[model samples]
Target: MVKFLKITAAIVILLLLFYFVFFKYRQIQANKILIPATTQTLFKINVDELYKTLAVSYLKHPSQYAGTDKNSIREKIADLNSGLRIPANIYIYALKGTAKNTLFTRLEIADTSAFNHFILKKLALLKKDAHFFESADSTFGLLVNKKTVSIAFNMAKEPIRHILEEIHDQNNMVKISDSKFAQMASLSDHLSFQDAENLSKINFTDGKIDFSSEFENKWIEPAAEPRHRMLNPESTLSFWLNGKIKSDLTEKNHTMSLSLLSKDSFFRFYQDYVDFEWTKTVTQVDTIVGYEYNDDFEQVEKKILRDRKIPSITINLNSDDKAVSNYLKSLGALDQSTGKISSAMIPLYQFYFRGSNGNVQLSTIKSAKPDVKRASSDDFFYFKVDFKKLINQTSIPLIADKLGTFSQLEIKAKSIGKNKIKLESELLFLNKDANALMQVLKVFQNGFKSALDLNLSVDIPVSK
Candidate 1:
């Protein structure tokens, strides 16, 4: 009887102790990575947080970048403090996502150089030393690898092709077999007959596209330039796309490659929005995030409980997982998705983009009817976009969920036909739960409104 009482008392004490160490106290993830030979200690920062900082940057500046040298731009990161003797131990990694926008007034009135010129400007700003930074040499800046993609509308213009040939100074371009009508069909169909039919009005009659494009050479980081040995120059990554409707989109399988001016830019893109873009090009993704720590789980668990107050604890070596589950349940990130925030990847075992697509179909059914004049027999729907910007300002819940789940996800994408297409996000899970996965998908389909219909707000899932 005495032994039983003693055992009960010990169990109760241990339970209380566990709560104080894990739930009540803050937690941090500690992992291992190979760094410069000069480093004394290395810290594994959360990839999700770092990416949020970047999402915020591009979201805030919608015009895109014009130069590569962004020293002033680097100084603008609000979260990253100035004058650091060394880099912080907290390194966020793998920031990635795609924002949808419309093409307005093509550069040549007919030539669409938005992807080449405008996108370059935005990317240049993102890779600038001031933005992709570290507190010091050993301060440890994460190579934030991000990809910026935009599909141009006026791709059908013959003159636009000629101008591109002139710009590249090469006439060896091969023609892509995809048809214009098929390409445009996948985008928003709000392009009224007046817009789609009047192709002649938007095309450049001249053999050249006479539009101004800004370029900045400062995109190359001098220090990170020499360290390009990690990633292979020629490697293909795969992606999965998800939407309410199943697609037969072949061209969407091929992704546009952007070779950066510097190695730092490459890593920066990877860190900022890794597989977020690469993996979402084909179907849905079911992610699994497993921890890889330097020490054994049992020993680390004890020490983690001892030091819970100073930093914070995520579900990892120290986590039993039950505490995290309870925490997430209270936060309402479990089965019931609240909205965009509900789509976010948070805590351990979170979900993203599983909710349903808010689909809106636009069609010119009346015009194509037999009685109508000059009616063509192709499907008549193109997306219409009325929004502030294609991309958001910070790390959204969906993006945060993506970075938290996978270490190096390979995201790939290409433009789907004429539609101003907004592909759905992929799923990132800490573990595999097919049932919860299905429920999340239903939520997304019901909650998320199609970006084609209206203006949307930027959802910063983690900060709030």
Candidate 2:
């Protein structure tokens, strides 16, 4: 009994060792395929890991994960798994050539015939006699081989075929372990992207999609001062630039804001003040007398109201140098009296000016002020858009329908190292309980449905 127990333990240990060794080998192979020749934009995804993430997310919120199409999505994934090799990394990269950049998708395949059939069915293409296929518009091309599949966008068929052949023949392709951007591949569980000077990683959490990018350039310098205090929380859109103005050759920081008067007033304000060239169809009725029988005839004429939507915008400048401020005042652009600057070019709107001695605020609305304290000193560039407010205020159905999922988008860039600047952006979702990736899929599904509805509603004139 002691010997048997010892033998059983030995067998278990051997099996565990073998499993880990094989896993490590597969990982190394997968990473080799992810390495690109040129340092352009490259996206890598581990299909097996992503599905595992989806499974956990589904278990957390089954009903809200992907809604009723959850099963459909799983079945489609299964179909793909049967053809393509799962538990492997797939890459989509842009190959930069002399003239232009070509986008290529490279993935390992398990069953060539099955994947070919899958592609044909999904693209609604008939089975061709050759292994290579191109779309009718020459925008998409596909090449299939025994071990791998290559897809190119906006490229010709011959290039993709040649690329596939070269990839197969190349024995000394660079491995991800030996590449400079290898660290980015490990940043995210499922997705990572790298470019010439930037490396980005994306993570899909429960509520929000987190995207972080690092810009590695020696020319990036830290901001001299914090400018976040100039931004208004109530503004629908805000942007800040902390640098010198080339035209005036002055070192000035600028902040711009688009503040809505009220939630209900945005559409009306936009139509009245913002859109200067917008036109609306109107019918005009005119009275006319018939020449032959003395009968009264009503003549109708269509008129267009050529008014466009414009929002009241505010621009604030902060600088220690008074050159720009003095120049604007001298040019009659910044009036010191009555705190109003007349708009000579655009007669419809006038500007309100306040402040002097380098710091200034110029706005179309008299009540607009730059007293909001929302700026971060660490960030040199900051931008924010309130999608929720825009969706609530807009009367357009398409804009509201498409952008209803997002609440706010905020992007910030800050210096992290001597030659590195980290960019962080968050896309807040309305549904906090569901997974962000699942919500993205739902958005695409809804987009497709909306497109189909639009196509069906279009009136086609029948030719006789």
Candidate 3:
């Protein structure tokens, strides 16, 4: 027992030592990138890493940027390393004063030796042609220090000098070794300045951005709430949003491409309203139609009509459900009987069956028939959108004819794996070989063909 206890105590001591060492290392690393919030908004971006990532992506898929002159592009990219002294780190701060908001950009240049030369060049150019800053020429000035060059625009020279003095004297400038913004920058290639308060509210991992409730209330709600009730002030939009360009392969099998993924939390409010329940019921009905109850459809339709609390009225001419069509015909919901569906039923059909084969058969309440033909597709998995129907439903005449010119859009997606889906989307033109728009399609097709050819053969020179 004594020997066992001694061994256990030794193990515990080693673990405690390891824990302290790890904690200390993490704290040191965190402190290295901690920056102060000097203004209402502060953004820190690592230009060196950003340029490197872009260069690698461009090398991998040189064909994507085909329209541009290749030699010129190479020269422009090379300039990043050629005596340009591009800042390793960039910070843009927006100072909100009582009178106005002043915007200042600070670049932490890698080499200070070329700083004076660069400033002199800018001053010489400004002297020759002051038209570049004719609007606020007097306010523009370059302040160069040990390793940083700060440029102030749209502000008086005295104020700019005073601000610089404050930064130097009070040490008010946010440092990458001390600010939360810098910590975030260290994790991601780019960061957007939201607010100074509550840095913990902004969480960054991989490429995903997770915001706290305060962030959602401040930024997201105001912009999205007006358009859709699904994204209300009370409703959650997305817990995590990620949009990143990958040069190297990711778990999702993406390389030299852009990927966007978001985790939506709107389903939390699924039971908040009757509309949501009805939507769920409609989805269940669709699933039932697809997988089971082909024979019971007649009984279902009859029961729906008899009950008058119709689950929903849907129009799908491709549907072989004679029972549902017959029931709608009996109620004058479909135009099959009298060559027109009633206007009273139009709104309900529009609400339930969003996308249909052609123009939504709409008529006045007093009108007996609709002039438009009813069409539908039999593909259960494929979604066909008729732009003409959408435009007619909105009744925006000015754009109606223009929108009607667009043919049907088909979108289909199939899950290829547990976390991957292959989406095939296409827009079909109504005019086939005759429309002038076909020429535009040909141009795009030719360009894509050229790009594919280049992708197979062309080699892009990547800078170190």
Candidate 4:
């Protein structure tokens, strides 16, 4: 009797050990399916883990958790999860192959009985369509196995089985090439949650999602330029962008600096360049013998050599000293004392320049003394722009027409190490109650403010 009891116990222990090893191995295989071979876009959701989180939250704050019925939520969740083959993670992929546009999802099912009871049993209750042989929807297909199940939807007119077979084939997968994929995988593993990498890989074709048709050359490379160290190491943002500018003024390897200035400095520079109306001087000049009035003159001509400040504003630009000097020389800089240039140097000066001297007063536009701030480090440069002044003074039809719509605008950029730069800007509406961005801007002067707003940012990397 003792020997028989010991034998039974040993068999039970062996069975438990085998089951544990199989479960672990299955989990490893399931994770590998998250990233398929060929796919335009990928999405993942960890339903099991997410449910656990919600369950914990509900336990902590029962009042905050809302539900329509008073049924046992935990039991329902357990039943749903048990019905799913693989409840921990669900992966969704957008693929383009035999079918022009199709969506494929792979699910691992552990308990076929539970799944049938919850889904297939319920589906059985619905009347079947005789022509389609299943349900009225001809776009969906379900392939079931003892351990796994596959569901697919084809937006094209192609048969559903063809789309399902294509997704099931491992060789048909298309992979996205980017560091973002690796980062997403790392995040998913860390959090034990469902995560996605690239969903923008798809483009619309015939009102359906398809892979982008554009092809990028992988062989051609850009030649390296002699590394020019950052001018301001402590600057806010800095990076190298290798691209050609249309103008003949700058080289292909153009280094740009972004910085901020105080409100006073910004206003001072704007007023000097754009504010040019002449006021009648009250200073009494020595009476001099004047020529006799001509028939064209209405009265004693008030033309006199009156002293007035030139309409010139000095600003420290992002370019090098030599570049700044060349830019000024291009604008016909005449004054050597203060750094100032003629309004003619600025493109579209006709609309923005309000100077009375016209072409004759070109020399009157002198460079103001530049408030040059040296960079403490060779990393990045920083500067602020007064958009209010820009909107008021700039006469460029394209931007001028749009500037009045925005109530507040602020821009900031920062360099992440030597290769990447991050830029952020905000445009706020004066009326927070507005629904659309255009509406917010149009009514910005009306003192309306909305809690909702539009925001955008970008991260750029410069290759070494």
In model 3, residue pairs whose N, Cα or C atoms come closer than 3 Å (at least 3 residues apart or on different chains), thus clashing, are 32-177, 34-178, 34-179, 35-178, 35-179, 335-340
TM-score: model 3 vs. ground truth = 0.36
Q: State candidate 4's TM-score.
A: 0.35
Error of 2 at 113 (Å): 3.8
Q: Which runs of model 3 end up more than 4 angstroms from their true locations?
A: 1-37, 66-71, 77-84, 96-100, 108-140, 145-147, 153-158, 168-170, 174-185, 197-464
Kindly report which residue stretches of model 2 are placed more than 4 angstroms away from their true locations once superposed: 1-29, 32-41, 66-82, 96-100, 125-129, 155-158, 216-221, 225-227, 230-235, 245-313, 319-337, 343-350, 367-376, 396-398, 446-464
- Candidate 2 lDDT over 275-315, as tens digits, reads 01111212222223333322355454544444334455676
User: If scored against the real structure, what TM-score would every candidate get?
Assistant: 0.14, 0.68, 0.36, 0.35
Evaluated against the true structure, the overall lDDT of model 1 is 0.24
| CA error at residue 172 for candidate 3, angstroms | 3.1
TM accuracy, model 2: 0.68
Top candidate when judged by lDDT against the true structure: 2
Sorting all predicted structures by TM-score, with the top scorer first, yields 2, 3, 4, 1
Q: Identify the candidate with maximal TM-score.
A: 2
Residue-level lDDT for 102 in candidate 2: 62
Cα RMSD, each candidate: 31.6, 10.9, 20.4, 16.6
Question: Lowest summed lDDT over 10 consecutive residues: which window, candidate 1?
Answer: 309-318
